[model samples]
Target: MAPPLVSLRVVLLYLRVLTVAFLVITVIILSTNSVTIVSQGNSMKFHFKDVYAYRYMFSAAIIGLFYAVIQLFFTISELATRTKNPFNYQLDFYGDKIISYLVATGSAAGFGVTKDLKDTFLALVVLDSTDPVDKLFSRGYASAKNKKLSKHQSP
Candidate 1:
């Protein structure tokens, strides 16, 4: 049977890589997302900055990505040296929990705002079912909103 420490180290590294990958994906999705609205021959573009929640979610993803990368570096170094540092362990424990909560709150805020805008306000106030431009705007809004929601799934 494989040693427990080897298994633990492998799992930890895998999860760290996964976290980085997800954060990168979240950043890419949120950063590139935009919505365009054409009304009465005037066109307006909306981006993540238009919504504070999305901005917050994007910031959290960026910060989390940095933290994950740093942790991954340390984890790799420790594994290669076959040495353990209690201080690093403590930092990892607290950092992981704090980042998780930060990202969770960001996701929740983004989700709530997106839900309200897409389901409640936009449906009733801004969109006209008969207008093709409005349909395009709605679809754009939905795509941006869904991408923002995906940030919550990251570690």
Candidate 2:
């Protein structure tokens, strides 16, 4: 039993390390999440700073940082205490619940932001531009519209 608990503690340590690494990456990406487009001496920028949903994601990442550190602390404290301590299970459950809800909310918010950004980018870069792919899609659309019109006009 003691050996299994030790192994579990080690595993938790590794998990915390991975969680911290991801949190750092999330912060950096959110902080620098922007792209600049220059065309014909005009420039436009798209970045997370201008989006509220992205801010929510960044906030979640910061929350995750604190959660991971606190989890690490609890893990260490559990190991330092005697094995008969029954409160560790409750602590684990509470920690997991809080982190779970936070991550779920973050995921939802991030998804909404990404979908919006994708639509905007496509409208700007694909629909309005004369790229070869756009021409192909445009031809298909015209044919579809013509077919619909012909069907409506049929005697």
Candidate 3:
């Protein structure tokens, strides 16, 4: 019969796989996002790279993905050999907590940026504008940030 520890390891492996996948998906989504706003016969474009918070979030996701993949490899090796090392236990203990913290901070930064923009610039511009074109402009502005915030749910 499989031991309880083995079952735990299996669950951990599944979680690590999920973490890695989600990080990758989030990174890809953030990379390709762009928004174009037109006001007063002028158009300006913005991208995730244009924002420092989004860049930080992207970096965090990448770092988390790299660590999650390495951890997955280690867990797989441990499961295959049915051997437990003290070093591996320590790493698993600290690594998970650290990565989670990083992801949380990244998500927070993105959320902060989104909220500030939505409440401040977005509201001001959209509310002050009576043009129908400005409504689409407002949606575009919000959509870009919303996409970043949504992708953050994975980790």
Candidate 4:
């Protein structure tokens, strides 16, 4: 006479586990695999700690991991006890919103870094193409940003 609440709960539990796993994987990737290149006797490297964006990525991943653990605890308690608390829905809603905000901020920061780094590396491959490539990138990026700004400003 009712919905499959147990099945729903089980599915949600699995989903939380999957989310934690994904965040852990992202943290690992961001923490390791820093890019290093030797130009002349000097070397340049891109590391998570050196970039704010990568730091955001790491922070988001860690925060998400902790949130997932807390969620798992509440969800497990609910399932085992077969009890529903009025606060669970509100708690879940707020938790989700907090996680979403963190993830979005991290994603935007990561995107900016990714675009700049990708262009820089590509230009590096051409050797001595930096100034011209940078000028071109400046124009293109400026135009794109202007368009985005204008759109956002419009009614």
Candidate 5:
């Protein structure tokens, strides 16, 4: 028997939960960092010397948090609609990946601009490691090669 079709409402609800979770986490982290930065004063020597640097960092964090939340929503929506809608499913994976990359890149750029070298470096690393097309193509090529070898061996 075929698996039961998933509901879009269920998916949307899940997305909503995920978005809330992300927001909560982001807020917690930002608040913690803010407190720490304020408390440490000049004791915590950050790379960014200008007052504008702090503004940039806060802005970047908020933007990154929002981006992450939105991405999660899209992913949930995609999964929810996938069985009933193959086209939407196809778009979701690529679209989410692209959006994620953009968010990461933007966050990193913001960090760089804000002189948060550590954050910038980490973002760059993450962006470098994720290549959906390369992974998909390589897996396909390997599977095809394996199938060809198996066919020859059977004959």
Candidate 6:
């Protein structure tokens, strides 16, 4: 069996690479598309909007960052709670309970932070009032909400 620490290190390295790649992509797209529009006629009007693609990319980055943090926390918690030694046959199954609490708390914080940031950014960039709500549901929350609703509605 592979050492637990080795596996955790591999996972963290993969996440770091993935995050750097995403950040690079986001910067490239956002910078390349940045523009300003001006309207001068009496009837003309102006509004600012995020490049739609950049908005999506920003949201994805937020989600990815949250996921990476949560994963790292879980890995750390697992390492802390493990009781098995290479030369010892005794193992504490109760360690898993601690891991569970750590995972739950980490996941909640990660998701909440990501959701709040995404909502705020979307509100700033989306000109229409309804666009944020539409984007929120379409991204991932709708499926999660539907699952909860179905659980409650089931007889």
> What are the root-mean-square deviations of the candidates from the true structure over C-alphas?
4.3, 15.5, 5.1, 9.2, 16.0, 12.3
Please give, for residues 5-102, the per-residue lDDT of candidate 1 as tens digits: 76777778887887777777777777776766655566667777777877887888888889889988988887788776988877787888788777
Q: Alpha carbon lDDT of residue 129, candidate 4?
A: 32
lDDT of each: 0.67, 0.57, 0.67, 0.61, 0.39, 0.38
lDDT of 6 by residue, 22-133 (tens): 4344333333432232223222121112334334444444444454445445545545665334322112223323333333343343345446745775556534344433
Instruction: Give the CA lDDT, 0 to 100, for residue 102 in model 2.
Output: 72
Error at 120, model 6, angstroms = 30
Candidate rank order under TM-score: 1, 3, 4, 2, 5, 6
Q: What is the TM-score of candidate 4?
A: 0.73
User: Which of candidates 1 and 6 reaches a greater TM-score?
Assistant: 1
Worst 10 residues of 1 by lDDT: 146-155
Candidate 5: pairs in clash:
none
Superposed by TM-score, candidate 1 places the C-alpha of residue 94 at a distance from the truth, in angstroms, of 0.8
The clash count of every prediction, one per candidate, is: 0, 0, 0, 0, 0, 0
- Candidate 2 lDDT by residue in tens digits, 1-155: 78887777777766666666666666665676565555555666656667676677667777767877787677667667735356757766776667656755765666655556555656666333434333323332332222222111000
**In candidate 2, which residue pairs get closer than 3 Å at backbone N, Cα or C atoms, i.e. clash?**
none
**TM-score of structure candidate 2:** 0.69
Q: Which candidate comes out best when scored by TM-score?
A: 1
Task: Tell me how far the alpha carbon of residue 104 in candidate 1 is from the true structure, in angstroms, after superposition.
Answer: 0.7
Task: Report residue 138 deviation for candidate 4 (angstroms).
Answer: 22
lDDT of 5 by residue, 33-87 (tens): 3211222133222222233433443354355456545645655654555543566
- Candidate 6, which segments miss by more than 4 Å at Cα? 2-33, 36-48, 83-155
